[model samples]
Target chain A: MAKSHEETADPSIYVPSQDEDMLKKQKKKEWKETLVGYAIISPWLLGFFLLILGPILASLYLSFTDYDLLSTPNWVGFDNYINILTSDPRFVQSLTVTLIFVFISTPLKLIFALGLAMLFNTGRKATGFFTTIYYIPSIIGGSVAIAVVWRQLFGRNGAINDILNSLGLSGLNWIGNPDTALSVLIILIVWQFGSPMIIFLAGLRQIPGELYEAASVDGANKVQTFIKITLPMLTPVIFFNLIMQTIGGFMIFTQAYLITQGGPMDSTLFYALYLYEMAFEYLRMGYASALAWILLVIIALITIIIFKTSSKWVFYESEGGR
Target chain B: MKKQNSKISDVIYYTFVAAFGFVMIYPILWMIMSSLKPEVEIFGNAASLVPGEFRWDNFSRGWEGFGGIGFDVYFRNSIIVTTLVVLGTVASASIVAYGFARINFKFKALLFGCLMATVMLPVQITLIPQYILFHNFGWVNTFYPLIVPAFLGGQPFFIFLLIQFIRGIPRELDEAATIDGCNKFGIFYKIILPLLKPALVTVVIFSFMWTWDDFLAPLIYLNNAGLHTVTLGLRNFMDADAGTNWGALLAMSSLSLLPQFILFAFFQKYLVEGIATTGIK
Candidate 1:
């Protein structure tokens, strides 16, 4: 049956006249369309090759060598990576600080976002106004100006300490104390919970009303319904937010650069900020390239781990009755 | 009983929201008020929302800026870079998205997968090499490193966003245009571009906001004081040993936030919708 279908489908083999001409013309048109498609997307295609692909490969190559900004790279295989892993105290400190920030701030941010989303999802009046108000921080969160304000707000004699003093409680220097310095940064991260909250709100909107109605009919309380219906359905969105927020947490630069400068004992020394210092400040371009690659690997590993575990919890409406 | 319970719940909900809202908004309010406060009065009256005396000197002083460069120069530079970035992002992303969404081509799926992978790849991975590449091209210290990438569809997020939006548009419209003697470009220009207004607005707002608020890119690229952006200008206000001019800093910070505040206040629907659609679907 396949052979017969192939024989009939090949029009040029039997219909050697107008039919063949038409087929050729049709094929030509498709080719022309494809060319036009490529033409339309040429900018991105060119960018992908030169800007993204070339740089990625170049960075990988540079990671294997020692190149300062002043001189050509001297080939030194695996030394940078080895030093980073075994000897560099600052690298270890930065890695630890970043991991702590990511682990602490991401979950806290997600929880705050989820909570706010749930609160707003309760059919309140003027939700639009509330969401907008909540979202404002996220808009200006990464600016140098905000970082400066954050510094002042947590400074020794700043607004936070002033409030503490008025309340009859002694205030420590929030930004100055090593123990609380990282916490100030984390607070900044958690404060910009708008994006994830909006995503959660969108996810909540997608939950079928019938599920809630059915849960209520079955005598399930609000908490029970949330756990059984809402949480399960929202898992996919939660997973997405988790991955994005985690990646963002790793690449955090501006806040630390502006607010802390990886000081107060390098408590808030983010990986990206350290990388910037290496490349720009220390002029260790090759070492920074290696650091960048390590960051990439770390992010990729985390993303893979999340995706690998997602099948267990992420619910898809299309995969119902499973 | 149910009505009374709901009323009680509503009151609690509003109170909770109001309290949290105050916390969220207080910092900004404080910043604005501090900007207006007298220099000595700023730290002295930190706990008070009301300024002891409104001082307009901070604004003038801040606007004068550090060194010879002023806020006007930084603002102009920001506007120039941001405008070009927004324009380039929209044009390139739309064109690229149209190709992905509407056209059938070889390696399309593979290319799209690569784009998605790149989205997850942290910018740090390519930062050094791109910097070096730009350095080699003598593009560093100029806006080329920042602005040219936008023209080349450097942002995967915006492209993905536009693709999602274009996919939502009906293919039947394209087919109708095709029948009316419109080529693919014509179909795009006449049909898709008009319908892509909302997504385009979202892209414009986002690109503008991100570029305006971006510190890292400008920090790395613009080494010249005259070419500094507003973010960089604000950063120069800090002197580690001498202490910051809090009044001037707050004043400039308030000014820095004004454009974003205005944009968000007016086009909030687009902003929320953008985040919702981009993230969820």
Candidate 2:
């Protein structure tokens, strides 16, 4: 039985010389491929070293120094961090604003985008047209012009209030009021939900039609089918949307920078915007680097937590298990 | 009975979706109308859905209002910057992506992962040091800082997207080319380049949209109003210190969106499909 098992396993294992020669030739081929590959991929490697990796390493060193733009950086161990964490209300405010924006916008976006995706998925007529129309806002929506338009629309005499007045109502100064400034931002973000919606639509297509058909034949109602089949199938896409939107939201800057100027009482001071103000406006390069590092840590922690939690809820089709 | 129930549910769904759509689109519609409304009528009848007069002259005024630097200059500058950036980025990113996807380098996966991590790193972290570096290099206040890095494969997202697409192509094609005595360069040129047309289109479109809309880079790098991109030019026009011309600003804003709108209308299908293919994955 042992001999038979050994023979079945391929006697190549026992013939060491033959195996070694084959392995040597395989390694030689692999070496050639690797060399050729390096030749082709050299551009990216060069880029990483020169542009990305080099800058990253430089920033790490700069964060340790009291560096302004004009002068040479002097070593100032942890002073920047200490000052930012302890003495800086601006940093705290920026953090609070960014967190609020991320929390509100991420959930709202996922719901709006997923809902719109469902709408397009169901609607029989010109689904492509609706998809395109919905997506237009996201494509052009990041411009300073759009942010300016958003500001005008929400300003004291802006279009939003105009509509409210037409309805025989008083209007709140949306962008000018501290309480409403960030809310207007939230609205702006939710409006640009078209990109995620397209992704969800693609995910929706991947769901087997027979599952829905089966659900219908089993006397399942529309809500029941959606709940039992569609939602579960779409969970992966929803997970993707959640992570991406969360990350995107955390990096929010342009809307606040252009619209509110982080104003109406600093209520809209997003972290990155504040970083810009510190580095450029105030010329506190060291402090700005510290802020950047803090933002990085926060983003990293959130992403790690998301990945850890994903194992519990994220469904994988190949595994045949949720 | 089930059919009837589903019909009602569908109606409910449509109502919910339509309400969301109305809200989603309302601000844009409102902006368009507001752009047409005169200053006198703006606040007086703020809620009027229709403008009293379609004040088409707002465009002309907005275009010419910026201290003799017509909106045409900013528009033209933006076109130049975006076109060059797109061409440069697409070319570099494809070459780099091809290298990563099709080549068999040592530690290839590790290197690729390192490249992707750059994407995760907030652009802000690199912002200060890069600005300083550029300043020392005398690239500041010029289009060099804006456009040169793109040619150096600066953007990780486009490279990653291209890599994913390149990997999906069959390796057998490369082997066949090699058997037919095509060199590595020939395989890349003849076999891979043709296959990557769809991905290249996607890269071009994305680069166009991003470069056109970028404000902060131009705000930081370019100091001269003469060299201002559309985003910067419009903001400069509306700056409170520079004297705000609301009507003129609105007109300029509308013009800024026109190119992207036109691009979208023409390539909406490819853009959407490309986004779905590359981004969603």
Candidate 3:
């Protein structure tokens, strides 16, 4: 490679009239390098257009039309959207259930994660082992097998109910009851708090020790330091975890699908599960596309709202203040 | 007095940690023990941690899965899909990351921004149209739907991760390579690729775990029992209408977790580091 470059850069072979030729060659080389760059990135660029960009635009168009899989799409304009807002009872219920799942599970999971993180942050000897143990749930939490296990665990004669029975209480069919089905799913969601716990642990580590030392010296108690120092310092990480967990909470399908199948009264009919049913099972592809768009809009709106409000509470130690 | 107070706190802290650790790992322990018990003994020994008898036949029975298919076939299918996905993800993501990290091409910032935006875009948004597209291409019920998009850089998260990693590499090395008459590809091949082992390992481990555990994509595409991944096969075992074989199901479930458990044991440092870095970014 070095020899070839030296041969190309040889000065003795060049004359004053060949300067334009050399300049042209340089321009060509530059263009060739640019093309090479594009060539290298073309896989992602092609996927972006075909899979992401094209699908997004197609979904937008499909949202306006009434296209089932077999038949040609008939243009229905905003009728699907309007009906979803006005008359579709299942849609309304799914939206409510999804919102409730997101609202309930996100905060609870965060709190559980934050609590564990704080406890572990005290520098225990077995912290590594404990962290690994906690993280196992989040790894397999979304698997079908785990969901099946969770189903059995909350079944009529399952382990949880067995424990309940042994404690001088009657066992309730937790997964079978419409009222408790969603709660059971929420418990599963909260149980997988290991990811956020890790993030919060990292955040806790980032908090300067001098702040705590100074607070202790000034006679502040643990609660005061937590509220006034640790919490404020960790707000950015909390904000990140909140957004990610909320988005994940909204898109939850497998657990609902595997455990309840949107069960006893459609009590656990999550948004993504409903969309899957509409598209694949019902073959209402167009309406499902519309539902997909609505989910996107809801996520976007929630994200925007969070970002808009983040300035109030999300402190950055580097920025000093917003 | 301070040391005495701290000692008491330490005792309380360890106790709390131990209790919570037990709660965290109880389900896994229960699953393992239940898998060893007889079908009737599962519910009977539900509240107990130990099995009365070690019925090892649960593994063999579960290995002989429902409807002429077996757990061996499912595991084979999963391995095939996951291996291809890991290869495709690492190759495509590294090249894409090199482009964004090293090259100053036209529309670079805009394209990078779009890539970032897609990371936040829910998979549900793209589900239907992609499904239709694949259906039109006669790729339904095949591994094509699961594997091809990966080769085309479908996962923006991995690309972005590699971009961060490649960006951290020194620009001086590229300039030096360029002065030595090495082309852009040469610079990448000679320098950046060799230096990207850590991030590439992170990507490989994540891609393996995600692909192994993925349920929805296979559920959507692979309708045939023969092509079913492990997740789909496990779901078939829990057919809501049919009476579930709890022993076999739990046995297979435990088996499904073995690969992940082993991977975690070996690569715990990289896994935790990957998650931490991703979160901070």
Candidate 4:
């Protein structure tokens, strides 16, 4: 732009060589733009290389070796992976716990989220206040404070039992029982339905009113309307919520780490919790790196699988229909 | 008859809403009320919202933190880390977003794709390597590891959030600024940043809350009780195997949530907006 202004301001007879000079100037300007672009994004460029990419590759390499924090990493060449796949009982245990947690909690959480979201999305007045109140848990749900309170509420002499006794019913040590321990965590996850609920609300709002109106015009009942128009339209949001929650569920650490300490017989040992213990608590950095890589693959595979299958279920409007 | 039916439905809806809302916030209210309860009644009167007698001693006791350090130290560490993180996230995210949204460079599409991909890259993937890097940097036991990456690029979500915003700031404004001799950087602060207020505030709120809530980093890096953030400090305050003062522990736990509660009270609009827009986090 400055070059154009300069050219207009010159208002002089152009020499033949001026064509080459103008082209050169244009090329220089393009080069300058590139330089400025890189300069502006230099921080991210530095961070991506140093923090994310470097660490990911280094972690992958470390997964192949056995290195405690003290000693140099000893390359064991697939031994760690072999043990994780073939032999490690805790690895199997953690994976089983994580898979169960993800599969159970995700659908239940989404169902609550979708059900509540549909209820909130009604054009009825004054629902915003209730929505806000309902959303409070998801905001602070992951905090250590809430996890602390959650532990107390289910403890032997805690509030849950306190209420149970007053109701003339017996109460078990909910946190200490292996059978109920994972269920307690699942309850905690489901309780914070605020996030996916809000996302569902947004998705619900995006749906065209005419779709429902058209269904009503066809004399469709409430259930028919919901199944015919609403469900398909809401599939995309459900898919997004599903992937996000599944990933989050797999990475659940603090609650298990703090509330259950990954036990009553390792019943609530989430994968991330186990990885943390391996690396930091047990100082098995290399083995933990292997665990981390396995987690990375698991998440990647899950995300990819969901995406691959999404075409069959996810109703994208731009694609015009399933 | 129709009016009566509608009226009955309205009553039912409100009743359901009130009951569910109460149940949703019950745990939080219980914690807050229990924080003020005397030790005997804290457990004894577990289901009661009203303590037998209000006790302020719990706060003072909790404030006298573990290892002779106080809650003030934890709060100070959290405040320092959160403030720096929020600032760094906003600044770096906005600048990087402007570059992607407004400029063209070699590998621009590829780089933009990289940014999008990193959003799904779990922090655990980098956990060990990052720890090793910081350890080699002599940054262990310091705030450097916790604080530095934030200054570098922060979250990819922040960058993505701001990129959407910058793209919406009509290109005419940038051209106008250019004609007035504003360079790219000049156009950024002068023409773009002020317009980016709401989006930047969103980044600020999210980063502040996330960094404040972050436990694993501080738990791993800052083992020294003196250097622990509130989240880390409170986690240690009540050791699972050891008997903890439940009164003091609940008191501090409730107190630790104050900043986020305050932020929520003030800026829930931005928080909700950010979440609804992204839907990933």
* Winning candidate number (lDDT): 4
B1-281 in candidate 2: lDDT tens per residue?
99999889977766765665666666666666767877666566665658888888877888884567877888888988898899888878888888888877789889888988886677888888888889889988789888878888858888998888889999999999999999777898999999999888878878888888898899899998889888988888878322246766776787788878887878787788976765531
The positional error of residue A300 in candidate 4, measured at the CA in angstroms, is 1.2
Looking at every candidate separately, what fraction of the true A–B Cα contacts under 8 Å does it contain? 0.70, 0.62, 0.70, 0.77
lDDT-based ranking = 4, 3, 1, 2
Give the C-alpha miss distance for residue B247 in model 1, angstroms. Answer: 0.8
What CA RMSD would candidate 2 show?
5.3
What's the C-alpha lDDT at position B28 in model 3?
83
Residue by residue across A1-322, what tens digits does model 1's lDDT show?
A: 5336445776455655676677668768878878988998999999999999999999999999999978999999999999998999999999999999989999999999999999989887898788888988888888877888898888888899999999999988887788999999999989999989999999999888998999999999989998999889989889999998888888889999888888888888889989999999999999999999998888889889999998888888888722
- Give the interface RMSD values of the models in order: 1.9, 2.4, 1.8, 1.1
lDDT of 3 by residue, B100-209 (tens): 99887777889999999999899999999999999999999999989988998858999999998998999999999989999888988999999999999899988888
| Chain A vs native chain A, TM-score per candidate | 0.93, 0.88, 0.92, 0.93
Per-candidate clashes, comma-separated: 0, 2, 0, 0
Model 3 regions more than 4 Å off: A1-30, B240-244
**Model 2 stretches with alpha carbons more than 4 Å out:** A1-36, B1-22, B47-49, B240-244
Q: List the residue pairs that clash in candidate 4.
A: none
What DockQ does each prediction reach against the true complex? Answer: 0.68, 0.53, 0.61, 0.76
Let me know the TM-score candidate 2 reaches against the reference structure.
0.91
lDDT of 2 by residue, A1-322 (tens): 5335435655555655675667667778889888888777666677678677777777878888888887888999999899988998988898899888888888888888887788788746556756766787888778887887787777788677877887889999887789998999888888888898889889998999999889888999989988888887888888878888888876777778888899978999999899999889988888788888888889889989988898788888888966
Q: How are the candidates ranked when ordered by TM-score, highest leading?
A: 4, 1, 3, 2
User: What are the per-residue Cα lDDT tens digits for candidate 4 across B34-153?
Assistant: 989888886777778888898999899899886778889999999999989888888898999999999988899999999999987888899999999999999999999988999888
Better by lDDT, candidate 2 or 1: 1
For model 1, what is the C-alpha lDDT against the true structure? 0.88
List runs of model 4 lying over 4 Å from the truth: A1-17, B240-244
**Model 3 TM:** 0.95
